[model samples]
Target: MLSKRRLTGTISNYRFYAQSLATASNSLLGELNDWETDGDLTTKIGKSLAAIITSLDALQHFKAEMKRSPLMPKRRNADAA
Candidate 1:
């Protein structure tokens, strides 16, 4: 089992990768528009990229909530006393 810090780091890394991929996807879409061809393919690829970005966003949010949860020992607030 990974430590809490390691787990959090892994999630953060994934979030960063997703963000980068989204930027690349947007760039590709822009190039497609400039070429003024294959609009249908561009739309399909755009939807796929959007879905990936949305999913990753949700995952990052869930990871944040997990870190804040009372059940996570490492994240427990000292002020809780």
Candidate 2:
């Protein structure tokens, strides 16, 4: 079974990756908008990219909320009682 600390670390890694992917996708979508003509294919690709970015953003927000909630274990310092 996975320990709480390991599970927290895994979620943190996932959140980091999701943020990275969302940022990259947003940048790419911006470049595509600036360079590509408004054709059916470009439009479809843009829509897909938008959907991906939205999903990633949502995942990050969910992770943040989970971290703030009481269910996640709080970090402790060695000096604390």
User: Residues 22-66, candidate 2, lDDT per residue (tens digit)?
Assistant: 776776676577665545656666765776777677676666767
Q: Which residue pairs come into collision in candidate 2?
A: none
TM-score of 1: 0.44
How much does each candidate deviate from the true structure in C-alpha RMSD? 5.2, 6.2
Listed in order, each prediction's TM-score against the native is: 0.44, 0.46
What's each prediction's clash count? 0, 0
Q: Clashes in model 1: which pairs?
A: none
Model 1, range 12-79, lDDT digits (tens) per residue? 87677677667757766676666656557666667657766776677677677766665477845789
lDDT at position 64, candidate 2: 74
The alpha-carbon lDDT assigned to residue 26 of candidate 1 equals 73
* Model 2 CA lDDT for position 80: 82
